[model samples]
Target: MSGPFVYVPPVNPVNYPPSPVHYHNSPYLASFYTDPNSPFIPPLSLSGNASPYQSPNTLNSPLPTVLTPNAVPFPASSSGSAFAPENPWNRERRVSWNGSVAAPTVPNSSWLQPPMYHYRRRSDAAAFPFQQPVDWTSLSPYAPYRTELVQQSFIHPLLNAEDRRNDLILDMSCPSFAPMRNIGNNQTAPITPEELNQLAFYPQAYGAHIYCELIPDLPIDIRYRPLPGYSPIAPPLKVGDILAAIWNDMQLGISQEMWASLDENRELMISRAYTKRCKIWASRGFPSMRNAGVKKVDCLLGKVFFRGLVPTGDEANTLRMIVA
Candidate 1:
């Protein structure tokens, strides 16, 4: 099955009107400026040459000249923008994240090294985990982190003792927000040894990744599937707790970015993720971490309640046969 996917909105509207023009300075801005309420831009010297479209009739007002029918489109400026100079799309971009935090156990990481840092292997599926500390220098917190909090853990607790099975182990599933590489500060600046120890203290405490990197073959969003055995059959008292959380999320949906802030700062994360890469890969999409941008992650988390139109599932053989 594919991953859950959805339609994305355009950053800029289509069939957009030509942007308003902003001449650095127009001599006419003084007498015929369209908006006196707005401060006048300092006038720039127009080369002595006359504009081809400067006609006596249109010259009466600065704003009218701009809308003149015979006006030749302004010569494109090479340095600034493809869209009209005043298009909001041309504004500067600013990316921000939580402040730079040092990991708890700062190992020698490539993040500390110069550009094009080297990456190395750390985790092996066959090997027992948590026997000793993982050398995370080879990995980066900014990259998708894969801790033990994979798909199995999501429904594992809900599983009955007899129904529980680890055969379908998932690696890149529940990613919390904490322990993310410092996108805001450490991105450009080098971290001190002290910050290293602070970041690694318990990276998993941050919470789950917004998008689950489960089965690789499926579309990231459309393929929402959970095993029948995954959801537990809790007795009575626990049902109320589940009901409350459902009410909170369903009736009171939180903004994805706000949730990320709260999730990363939580005293205790429902789960954790490791920065190490796994040796084995899964066939289906499970809840796991993958390289996703903040906007994409926000979109994924925001649609927490979206459902698929087709039959999304992990039963490969059944799906293939149905397609046939």
Candidate 2:
């Protein structure tokens, strides 16, 4: 409970009229004042023993405002529920303090928190939402690496390297002089290291050609198998045909000679007239010769293939096959 007042008139009443009156009338005020340490005392009664402050019907009624014994009682004319409010500052401060105490209890007042700061969490451990896991089939360090085996009967190095060393040529070829062979693996003198490497990379047609050369007595019937499920031989044998077949088996590497030979057959050749207008086009690198460039280069190479200096047919087949 708040301390009780003693009656005392303000010296400067015009300026400090709201000061507590306890100092002006302590003796009378003390008689009614609630003691700081004592249990509450009921208000004085109209009857000798009946308490006036204990009426159940008037429990919620406004309590009387106390005044000092020496001071004149002011008429009850104020509109405020709180007693002794003399200035707007005290009234406003009480209203503000009450509002602050109630703020957390009101659901509608949740706007007191900033919207952007609400529900925010640190993203230090967040992962990229769209990131895919690494592929272990492509990244496994101990995965086996396979070495390719060249087929014995194919003509081109590129073709030979694609198929394992199984060929009808070696199976049917004569064991005598001019026997069909498996290129570098033929029973002959040691092939040069360079040729051995080439043999390793040769396609079917070149492999067959190498086989034929290694064993001169090898029969032509042994060189290539008939197409699957039929007895028909692979196709009409031409040096360019063998070269083209082998060329098909390559990844992207094509020999200049084979490319030129390919031009004679494909008819997509480079012409002097076209190159003269574009020297840069003429001097471009071999791999770059593709599409329109391939056509142009083929035209130029075809002319050289048909020149009198180059022989045609099986007689010149060896030279044509090798150079290409």
TM-scores for the candidates: 0.13, 0.15
- Shift in Å, residue 59, candidate 1: 99
List candidate 2 stretches off by more than 4 Å.
Answer: 1-226, 232-304, 307-317, 321-324
Off by over 4 Å in 1: 1-161, 164-166, 172-255, 260-264, 267-290, 293-324
Q: After superposition, how far is residue 189 of candidate 2 from its true place, in Å?
A: 46
Q: How many angstroms is residue 169 displaced in model 1 relative to the true structure, after the best TM-score fit? A: 2.8
User: Could you tally the backbone clashes for each prediction?
Assistant: 47, 49
| Model 1: per-residue Cα lDDT over 182-261, one tens digit each | 22321312222232222111111111111123212222211112234433332211211211221122222223555465
The C-alpha lDDT values of all candidates are 0.26, 0.29
